[model samples]
Target: MPNTIVELRDVAIYQRESLVLSEINLDINKGEFVYLIGKTGSGKSSFMKTLYGDLPLTQGSGTVTDFDLRALKEKDIPFLRRKLGIVFQDFNLLPDRTINDNLLFVLKATGWKDKEEMDAKIEEVLGRVGMKTKGFKFPHQLSGGEQQRVAIARALLNDPELILADEPTGNLDPQTSVEVMKVLQEINRNGRTILMATHDYALLLKFPSKTLKCDGSKVFEVVQKNV
Candidate 1:
């Protein structure tokens, strides 16, 4: 069987005092590209937070990139993050830094100290996302699509086992969204497992995969045709 990157069985997700999702059972294997779709306030963010060690997993059982969600500790969060990459709706790049500097900052923060090695790794990732020539440009210098590409490049720095993208294209225009989607699709095709949470149904129809839906306090898999 293929190796599972994310597995949750009978899981429950919460936001502060209230429960948001219950009875969640999911299996995302290596090299799979899955889509997470739900309406606003439908526990999508809560579910993503649970996976990334933001919200504690208090009920059921779950594992992400070999880390037990139920047993994850504050100190362990950084290590867990190294094994997984997270992309948010906002680019989150430091506005004061150039794209290359932004990526370098993450590498240093993650304990990469060798300048030559870091530079080589940065080049590799930027090339993968079609932004090798634009690394010196500031965040504001690039368009939304380019900024998102840089964000994706930043996520790839650690060679993560899984990538969690939350509304990655939510801020871009329709055409720019397609560009970002194509970049993501290319990454998936190259064997990186990705779970993207989005409300963009048009993208669903354009590039369908194993889809999961969060609705009515539950998370379940849905066939692409029905989505």
Candidate 2:
């Protein structure tokens, strides 16, 4: 049996005395895809923050890719981030740089010393997302979907073990959302775990995977065995 990639045991989060999440217990194995659904301000973003170290772990224990999130040091965040990929609703690409430069910047920041290897990796991931020809283009030059593809490429540059997407397709049209879902699905099929927080029930019906829902100030595994 394989080890768990993401584990949250009795995790709790508070926003300056206001508790956002209460007792979130979960275990995500390698290569699994999960949907996180909830209302606005229902601690969905807070959960993502906890996983990425944006918010300090206030209670309970958690781990991502073997890193003890509760005991993680500040300097160790970069290392943990390398094992986890985070995607956003708004494509956070550097408008001033070309797509290739955007990816190269991350590689450099992550301590990549070989320029040739970085360039090769850039080309490889861009091709993987069908954006090989757009590496020279700036973020402003591409459509919404194209820019998002570049962001996805950036997230993939490190080849993370798991991808945490916070409303990845929230800003796109219906057709474009499907396209983005295809990209994410392909990534999952290739053996990377995906934990996407989405309000799109169509996506849930279309993809059909485990659903982890944030409700009643706690995160629960909503499934047939318990339903």
Candidate 2 matches the true fold with a TM-score of 0.96
lDDT per residue as tens, model 1, 71-154: 999999999999998999999999999999999999999999999999999999999999999999999999989999999999
- The CA-based lDDT of model 1 is what? 0.95
lDDT scores of the candidates, listed in order: 0.95, 0.89
Model 2 agreement with the true structure over 133-225: per-residue lDDT tens digits:
998888999999888888888899899998999999999998898899999999999999999998887878777889988888989888723
TM-score of each: 0.98, 0.96
List pairs with backbone clashes in candidate 1: none
After superposing candidate 2 on the true structure, give the runs of residues whose Cα lies further than 4 Å from its correct spot: 224-227
| Superposed Cα deviation of residue 129, candidate 2 (Å) | 0.8
